[model samples]
Target chain A: MAQPIISFNNVSKRYPGGREALSNINFTVEAGEFVLLTGHSGAGKSTLLKLIPAIERASSGTILVNGQSISTLSGRGIPYLRRNLGLVFQDQKLLFDRSVFDNVILPMLVTGQSHAESTRRVRAALDKVGLLDRERANPVALSGGEQQRLCIARAIVNRPTILIADEPTASLDDEYADAIMEMFRSFNQVGVTVLIATHDRDLIAHSSPRVVHLQRGRVLDKATA
Target chain B: MNALIRHHLHSLRQSGVRFASAPFAALANMVVIGVVLALPLGMYLLVSNVQSLASSIPTEPQISVFLTPGAAKTDVAALENRLRAVEHVRSVRFVSREAALASLKRSPGMADVISTLRENPLPDAYVVTLGEGSAAAAERLESELKGVPGIAHVQVDSAWVRRIDALLSLGRSAVILLSALLSLALVAVTFNTIRLQILTQREEIEVSKLIGATDAYVRRPFFYWGGLLGASGGLCALLLVFLAQVLLNRNLSEFGNLYGVELRLQFLPVADAALFLAFAALLGWVGTYLSVSRHLSKIQPR
Candidate 1:
């Protein structure tokens, strides 16, 4: 009954020099839904996720996130928009120069949260991601799966309503990947909207959430759970 | 409001940490800025000190009017009255040839030379002191007195003072030009230093931006770094200038002994020192702004 939390209507994205990343895409994500974007490499999953945050502009059509048009957002508005959205990249963009705690505390710092509140929330987020004990360790000392979890801690530290992750479980053993998926599941159970992009069919098969499949730059199917 | 203050304090602490992490590089940069700033500051102090010394000297312009050898006593008296009647002439004193000879004989070495002379070789003279100390006014009076009757020559004694005034003016201009050039150099040093820092922290910047850090938020630490660097540089320059003053005064006291005057270079005034530090900090802020605005936009998280 309520307006969809994210609605993409006939959206298209064409990079410079004439390479189309997404075409005529249409989707609507409810406020508390968990959706999986499954597509092979170079299938525009990353590009589609980037569009929600206005990292890449849409070539045509409109994307409304929380009822605000992404196409009309100004440069100054992008940061505020990103503040409400948690994003995890495929490469685990963690700052190795600082402690794991500091890396996790960046979003709070950016939003100018009070130091006491930020520390409490950061510790709570770290605990949620099972990294509370390793807060003082440098990110460089983290294993690949722990690094992925650290990135998730940073992403969710601000308590963003929408969580968008690209290849969050890539290059991990099944045990680590299952642990990460279980973390996302727990967050989703708490009513945070989760959107994940991955090409792993086995991971997709194990999940019971709605699945949006993409082939090349077009949406192949949207399967309701 | 508390959060904003905390954020600013955190940014400032981060800048301080950066300098602490690389102490040697930071020291070298501050020293470079100090030496560059000191060049003009030192020149400024030297010029001001010289001007003060020149002012301390007696500046009352006087003209010496020499009478002809055959001038009568009445002629000498008439000339003195005439000098007193001149506009801006404060006072006049007449020195007779006998009085001049008597004064010369009182000299330790000049008495023997004067005793051998048959008559006083000196001509009568009138010493005219002007109320206005300007060289132009003295020169105008000198020319007018030179054409008067029973007057052989009129010499303006303030010519050397005018020459010193001109030299001091030139020195002031040199100080301004050097200050302009060295201030530019200070900005350049800050710009380059910030550029290198931005490069080293490229990844951090990208990640910060991706997580919703505004341009101002990203720039806050670098701005603090630059401002601290410049403030420290200004303090270092003040120290350098003060040390130089002490050393120069040590040598100048001996030099002053030869001239029988107390010559000591004074340190920069408190107001001037504070203004210099503020100016250096502003330059650093400008450099950091330029470096951040130019380079920050180019780095977008891919």
Candidate 2:
């Protein structure tokens, strides 16, 4: 019912060596949709995911996030674009020297949110991930599963309208992977535009969210085949 | 700016936790910067002080005007008064031919030579002291004295003043040159230390950048670290300067005991201490800013 949260128009990325990573790629992931982007390594899944939050600009086209053109946005506006989108990594990439509270508060802190506000929101986000009491624990002390969840909590601490998670559960066990996917599903159920880049379709195969798989950086229709 | 500075300080503190392993490197860099800066500063103060002491010797730069033979005593008196009235001449002393003869005989080296002379060939003269010691003043006084009717020629005694002035200027220039070189070393040492800190924090920076950290958000801690290092280094420099002054004062007092004058060496004052702190902070901030900007900008984890 609502407008598409993200839209790519004629997007193409050519590396410096004259290699085209993505060729006129077009895709739409609307609000409240859980779109999974699956592809082999170097197939441009990361590039496509990176474009959603304006991390990397398109070489030839525009990317609209929440109806705003991302590629045209200035460097300063990239943070605002990112404010509406949460990005998670498989390695968890958390500052291990800091406490869980510090890790979760990072995004809000980057946006220059006040300490009281950041603390309240960080606690709430950690609570959502069921790591409320582990706020004081160091990221290094956490298991692989806990670390990924902590990454999730950090990514969503800003309450972004769209969540672009790249391989969120790639390092986790089956149970932890299911947990992370379930967290994504719950966020999607609450009307977030979730576009996850992952090869772990088994975690969400039964649920049947709209799957947009890619092969060699081009869209493929596995269903009809 | 305060928020930006605070954030940098916090980041520095965060990064500093893991950097505990390399405390010696940081301290060594700070000490090296402090020592390097201190050397030229100390030399500058010493040279300036010594030059001031030498210039305050209180001997006026003077010119001697000898009267020609058979010149009228009245004319020579007039010339002496005229020399005294000249703006450049502080005052003039008149010496009659006989008095000049007696004084020459009393001279340590010339006493025997004067006793051997058949008559007092020494001319009557007027000695002129100028208010300021300079080539122009000396020339002005010399020209005026030469113009007097009874005067022979004016000999300006200005060699010592020129020698001392030249020495002071040369010394000051050397101090400036030395200070410049040391300051470069100071910045380089601080910069390299900060660069290593940046290098060491590459992982932390990459992780922070990957997780939506803005450049400022990421750079806060390092900025503070640099600022603190510089500030503390400034404190170290100040203390070292003060300590050096104290040691010099002791040595000078010992020398005074040898000379029975009880003199002391002066240290940099409170104003200088404040300036040193500011200088230290500026150098540290610049070094850190340079290193952090270069490294943090390149830390793209993807």
Candidate 3:
């Protein structure tokens, strides 16, 4: 059996207002698992994801990623941690000037990949995402659905072991959301670990993935014996 | 790897183009730097030339000893010989009272007055000269001449030399002040330019950081930018100084005729020019480094 890729042990977070964002949160994401975190707004779902990449430090307890203490990771190691873990956003934070091809190769550039190899990999990733012919086209020219896929392609181009996506389908229509979910499922069907935060209730209606429910800053769901 | 550098160079190339006007800003900065340096530099040149003019006055006939009235001619001649024998005196001339009276009467306005005068009331004078223009030599000659019998007064007419010496000292103090101030201005200008650049390219820097770019790698182009500005400014200042020298050189004959001294102005030496440019380059690099380091550290990915 594969070891747990992400572990949150008694995690907690406190904002400046003394409002507890996350309280004693404990969870484990196994290798190749697709986990959905379902919660209302301000339920600490975003804070949970922020803690993993060392973007935010847990106030108490510890979190581990790939057997490394992520809670103790310094700011200097954040980029390295990000390189190992892919992050995708719904808004698609892409450099407007670069083409689709350059956008996809961003991770490889961070990794200091050689020109030819990075180019080949970028082209291949775009081809996988079905935007190969649109390599030279700007992200603005692509449709909303295509843009989201481009963001996904960018995230996975460096072959991160774990992918963290925040609100992947909040802004998309039903059909586009379904297409994105299908893409995520395809990626997870392989060896990639997928963790998604979304409020699309219908998203988990038919999907059989394990659900972690949260109310405010506390876990409300209990697994049946 | 080139893939990263390619992205880095061309990625912000859009920003570089959008702000393609950045190089023009840098050029303007260079002009300002040149002007600032030229201020002190021009003063230093003018004062140096004036110093040359002062020192170029014959140090050989450095002092004059006016004789007292009724002093005998042979007595003055003997005094000249004795003065020349002194270690401080390089040479001496004995001007007879009759010769002084004749020269005064030769003047246009004084000719009639001197013809009406019955006797030559002028004193026979011994004009003393010194080997070097040093204070010790002047003091030695003064004490020796004052002690001479029948010598009424020993006037060391090197008073203008004393005034010139004071002016040179004042000029040196001004150089210290202006050089310090102008260097500060140059550095501040470079720092502000780099600070503006950092603000404009915040996203590019963030992306570079995201791509695992090291601090050194991110700082390279800015180093080039600031250094190029500093060096180019130094070059432009050199040109301005050369133009000034040429202007002075062109009018040298007129100034020579007016002042009765050669005023051939000179450009800075090659070694000085090189040192100027090197200083500019170092200051530019330091200024940009400070700006970039301060601004870049403020941005950490959230």
List candidate 2 stretches off by more than 4 Å.
A222-225, B1-22, B54-60, B64-87, B93-127, B133-158, B257-262
Candidates, ranked, TM-score: 1, 2, 3
DockQ of each: 0.74, 0.29, 0.32
Candidate rank order under DockQ: 1, 3, 2
> What is the lDDT for B201 in model 1?
93
Q: What ranges in model 1 sit over 4 Å off? A: A222-225, B58-60, B67-70, B93-125, B131-134, B147-149
TM-score of each: 0.93, 0.83, 0.79
- lDDT per residue for candidate 2 within B1-302, as digits (tens), equals 35455465556666576347568876786687778777877787788677767766754677878878889879976776676676656777777789978876775567877778888787877777777545677777677566678878778776576777788889899998987777677677767877877787687777556555677776777777777677777787777877888888888988878744666666667797788788877877888888877767776766
Worst ten in a row by lDDT for model 2 chain A: A216-225
lDDT tens per residue, model 2, A1-225 = 878778888889887898888888877777788888887888888888877766667899878888898878876666566667788875667887679998788776666676788889999899889899899999889888888889889888889888888888887789988888889889988887788888875855754458787777677774621
Say which candidate scores most in lDDT.
1
**Judged by DockQ relative to the true structure, which candidate is superior, 2 or 3?**
3
lDDT, each prediction: 0.89, 0.77, 0.78
Model 2 CAPRI quality: acceptable
Please tell me the interface RMSD, in Å, for model 1. 1.2
Error of 2 at A179 (Å): 1.4
lDDT by residue (B195-296, candidate 1, tens digit) is 999999999999888999888888999999999999889888999999999999999999987755677998878999999999989988888888888888
Prediction 3 TM-score vs. true: 0.79
